[model samples]
Target: MVIFSVLYPATPGGRFDQAYYDDVHIPLVKEAFAATGLKDVQVFKGLSAPDGGPAPFVAMVHLAFEDAAAMQASLAGPRGAEVSGDIVNFSDITPIAQVSARD
Candidate 1:
């Protein structure tokens, strides 16, 4: 399996609508990605840093796919564009993305 991650940095005045993200955006992601071998998804909400400071990121999402090729396919085509474009509906911060394979 492969993991595709999206992380949002915590800006001083960052604006994120968690409710909309959970209720609206995530469902859109599931719908768009499921057709391309998306297996599962996990979400994280950053609370604090190790030293008790605000976490560097406000939130993160991990999408699991059948394989590396499946991951790439998930991000291609019109459905991918639809999922990506929905980011503006809930957040102003640009997300950081990474792809990794399980050991």
Candidate 2:
């Protein structure tokens, strides 16, 4: 499986509406990518670092796909724009994305 992770950094003055992200954005993502081999979605909300400092990211989302091809196909399709464009509805921080293969 391939995991696509989107990480939102914690920045001063950044805005994040966790409630909207949880209630609206996630459902939108699931709906948009359901047919493109999307298997599961998981979200993580940051609390603090090991030293009790600000967390590096305010939130992170992991999208699991059957394979890299499926991921690419989904993102390259029309729904990708819809999902990506919805970011503004929740947070202003630009997300850092990474793809990883399960060990």
Candidate 3:
């Protein structure tokens, strides 16, 4: 599987509206990539580290696509623009993203 991941760092006093991410942003992502071979989506809310320390990140997202091409398409064109533009509505922390290939 090829996955696109966007991770929000846990910055001191940073703002991340989890409610908006779950209620609104996620749904928007779904609709935008529905036709781009989006297979599934997994959203993670960082709670704590193994030692119970602060989590390194506040949120993480994994979006599964059919392949590299499909993943690329998901981040291109008009739909991609919509997804990128929606970030400011929810959080202020810049997300770290990557594309990975998994077995």
lDDT tens per residue, model 3, 49-75: 889999999999999999998888888
TM-scores for candidates 1 onward, in order: 0.95, 0.96, 0.96
Name the weakest run of 10 consecutive residues (lDDT summed) in model 2. Answer: 69-78
Q: Which stretches in model 1 have alpha-carbon errors above 4 Å? A: none
Query: What are the lDDT figures for the candidates, one per model?
Result: 0.91, 0.94, 0.92
Per-residue lDDT of candidate 1, residues 1-103 (tens digit):
8999999999888898988989999999998889889999898999999999989999999999999889889898569989999999999999999998875
Q: 58, model 2: CA deviation in Å?
A: 0.5
In candidate 2, which residue ranges exceed 4 Å CA deviation? none
For 1-103, candidate 2 gives per-residue lDDT tens digits of 9999999999899999999999999999999998998999999999999999989899999999999999998888889999999999999998999999985
How displaced is residue 68 in candidate 2, in Å? 0.8
Best candidate (score: lDDT): 2
Q: Whole-model lDDT for model 3 versus the true structure?
A: 0.92
- Candidate 1 TM-score versus the reference: 0.95
How would the candidate models be sorted by TM-score, starting from the highest? 3, 2, 1
